[model samples]
Target: MGQLFESVVMAVKAIFQNKTRAFLTMLGIIIGILSVSLMGTAISGIDQVFEKSIESMGQDVLYVEKFPWFMMNDDWWEYRNRPNIEEEYAQQILDRSSTIAFASPSSSRRADVKYGTQAVEAVEINGTTWQEAFITSVKLESGRFFSELEDRYGTRVAVIGYDIKKNLFPDEDPLGNYIMINGNKFRVIGVIAEQGKFLGLMSMDNIVTVPLKAMKSVFGRLRRISISVRPKEGYTVDQAKEELTFIMRGLRKLKPREADNFAINQQEAFRQQFSNIRFAISAVGLGITALSLIVGGIGIMNIMFVSVRERTKEIGIRKAVGAKKSIILFQFLSEAIIISLIGGIIGILITVALVGVVQKFFVAQLSFSLVLISLSVAVLTGIISGIVPANQAARLNPIDAIRYE
Candidate 1:
């Protein structure tokens, strides 16, 4: 153990003595390890962000809509030709399906909400029943959500999103306060909990939800609804979907051979789609990160070869003093390993800090668990890069090595 410690100390001194060369040699390992570490951290962060967003919208809930939520691409004309699905159909399907526990129809429109002289423009106005809030796992931060009685009565009451509440009523209570939408005056019934935005598109905190019946009265001729469904405790989601399909098919009067008019949005389906995207992103990151490591390894190899040439006389003198070839090999190998290990530590620190900075925008946090992986790869790279040169130095004839200039 003492001898090993002495060898490591000597390697450290040699590195400091040739500081510029040592740093130049370490640059490749540093960059390679850093790239891979950063990539792993970044990918992990993105996955967490996606999971949090999905979780915010209840994991057990599924949707039944006319159009697919995540289609690759569809023609505008095709969308125009699509028939409008009715809310009554969703209720009929829910009533008929034994596997389903509860279901509700949801619709959305863009509207400007005005509070006194202030106006929040282009806020998404959602039309849903009281059950919709429970299905979406939406919790009221203040006041109360619209009751079934309110929906049945078509009351002109609205639930404001957290951001909307903040913007419109910074100090005062939003509940019972009237907000004007176009010419309609609606009383704020509740303020939703602050939820973060998703994919840089929509702000989850900036939406307003009102009763479906009241929305239909104001907007007129409501066509489609975003239906949320929950499966019964004993039944799997697939069974619920199957039963739902049968009910919808019968309701639409479609023949067994004909294609169904509606689409089912399952949570598992979103998970699968997101998983595919995550895998693709991981593959690309790994590929790029691997290239960096490979380049660094090559750099280490080149420097090691030069190091062997420069230390030829030292090896000869050691061999003459009864030092074995293994000692000479170990010395050079240890030096390379030290450089890589130090670089790996630095890389990890930087990568972690970067990931932290990126997570600030989201309500959720990012996590990394690739420290062991980075260290292993770093040490392995160092040993592999040093092998050829270490072997060459060890095999050198002492007599010839001593005589060489």
Candidate 2:
């Protein structure tokens, strides 16, 4: 332990004697560690944002549509030609399936909404059944969701989103107030709780919802619709999906050999797609980071070689005084490791500061695992870079190195 401590002290002294060269040697390592840590933070932030967006869509809900969310076999035309899913299927599923707790058909269109003089343009207007409240995790900030009777009788009651309420009814309570959608007058019955951005791109709070019947009356029923279904409390998702598929196949009247035309999608589908994207991003990011680390390692190796050459006479004198080769090797190797560790610490500090700045635009997280990973990479790089130079120094002949002018 004492010998190791002495070697470390010698390494520090050597490094301090040539502070400028040591700093230059550490520069590459600093940049490499910074790049890797920042990349990790960005990926973690993206994942968190995606998870929040997915949570808005209930985990237990399944979406039944004419086309699948992900392309299968590059067959775009095949899905495009599929028949449009209709609102009637939602009722059929509810009536026929025992495993389904709730089912609702939903469709969307972009339109301008107005209350008196205040107007919000290009707002998403969703047409869905009252059961949609059960199928999704929609919470109300104020007022109440539309009743089943209103949905059945095609009442002109509407539920507004957070942004709509903010823009249209800045001061006054939105409940009991009539809003104009396109040209028709609809009473606002509820206001959805604030839901931030979806995938950090589109605002989830900029939407308005009304009864399916009312939407069809206003916008026509030719547009495609999707059914949202939730499994009963006692049943699993797979069981619900199985029951739903059987009923759908029966409703569509597919023959024994004929394939079903509809698609059943779940929250996992979105998670899988996001996971693939994240994996790709990680691969590319790590690849680039590896390149930077490689360059940094090469720099360290080159500098170590120059250091060994300059200290040849010093090494010879130490050997003549009976200094072991292992001690000499440890001394140089310790210097390299210490330099890398310093760079790693600086890089981590910079990353923490940058993460705070990045959080203003998007969520960026830095965890202890990332800190350990950066430091480990630095240590490994130092060891690998110092091996050849340390070996050369240890193997130098005492007489020849002492005589070197």
Candidate 3:
């Protein structure tokens, strides 16, 4: 322990004596650590962002659609050939499925929504029943959702999203105010609370929802419609999916051997698709980043060799003064380690500052585990770099080394 402490002290002195050279030698290590840490932080941030987006879509809900969310080697034409998903399937699912809580039939179209010329272009106008509010996550910032009577009568009542509220009526209360769509005036009955982006890409807040009956009146009933079903409490998503499959099969009158036409999709699909995406990203990112560490290690080795040559006479002096070969070996090893470790620290600090600046816009968190890993790798790099030069120094003949001017 004493010898190690003494070696560290000597290493510190040596580092301070040639500060500029030491920093230049450590530059590679700094860059390497920066690359590695940045990659880890970026991947972690993406994971967090994905989780939030999926949560917004409602974890318990299953989407019954003609096409699957992810298309993996499956033919799009095959899916297209499958029968269209029916709006009546929602009530049928509710009646027949034991695992289902409630099912809401929903359909959408892109339209320009105007509130006295403050228009939002291409905003998604969703049409669903009053039970739609019960089947999914729909927290209101203002008024209540439309009642069953309102939906049944095709009342021109609408619920708007936060972005629509902001763009259309920034300063006024939107509740009971009339918004025009296709020259038809619909009263705003509720405003949905601000839900952040979907998958960090599209806004969840650019929407206007009305009763399905009212939508059929304006847009007609020819477009695609899908059901969003949630599982009953105490039942797993797998059980709900199984029940949905059976019900759909029975309803469609598929034989024991006939393949079902509809896709039973959930958040797990996103998880699966993202797993592949994450794997691809890590494979490419880590491969490129690892090269930096290797180059840094090589640079450390070359500098340590030069350092050993410069301090040859000092090694001889120490040997003549009763210093053991192990002490001489540990001294250079400690110096090399300190250099790389300091470089790693600097790199980490810079990464932390950079991530902090951008985290508000996106996700970029520097975890403690990543910090430890970077430091550990830096120390390991120093050990590997120092050993050869350290061994050469330890084996030097005292008289020969001292005389080699």
The TM-score, computed over Cα atoms with residue i paired to residue i, of candidate 2 is 0.91
Give a tens-digit lDDT track for model 2, residues 159-259. Answer: 99999999999999999999999899999999999999988778999999999899988888647698999999999999999999999999989898988
Candidate 3 local lDDT, 1-405, one digit each (tens): 997899999998998998998888888888888877887888898899899898878878899989889975668888889899998898888988888888888899999999997888998999998988877777899998999999889999999999999999999999999999877899999999998888777899999999999988978873778889888899988999998999999989999998878898888999998988888878866775577667777877888888889999889999999889999999998888999899899889989998998787787899999999989988998898888888888899999888766
What TM-scores do the predictions have?
A: 0.91, 0.91, 0.91
Higher-lDDT candidate among 2 and 3?
A: 2
Q: lDDT (0-100) at residue 37 of candidate 3?
A: 86
Q: Single out the weakest 10-residue window by summed lDDT for candidate 1.
A: 360-369
Worst 10 residues of 3 by lDDT: 284-293
Clashes of 1: 0
Over 1-405, each residue of candidate 1 has an lDDT whose tens digit, in order, gives 676676788778878898888777777777777777776776666676677678777867778787776765654446446566778876797778898887888899888999998899988889988788767777889889899999999899999999899899989988999998766889999999988766433679889999999888888866577788888788987888888888878887899898866778876777888888878877887787687777778887888888889988888887888768887888888888887787787777776676677666633232445888888899999898878888898898999887767
Clashing pairs in 2: none
lDDT of 3: 0.88
Stretches of candidate 2 off by over 4 Å are: 1-28, 321-323
Off by over 4 Å in 1: 74-80, 199-201, 360-368
Clash counts for all predictions: 0, 0, 0
What TM value does model 3 have? 0.91
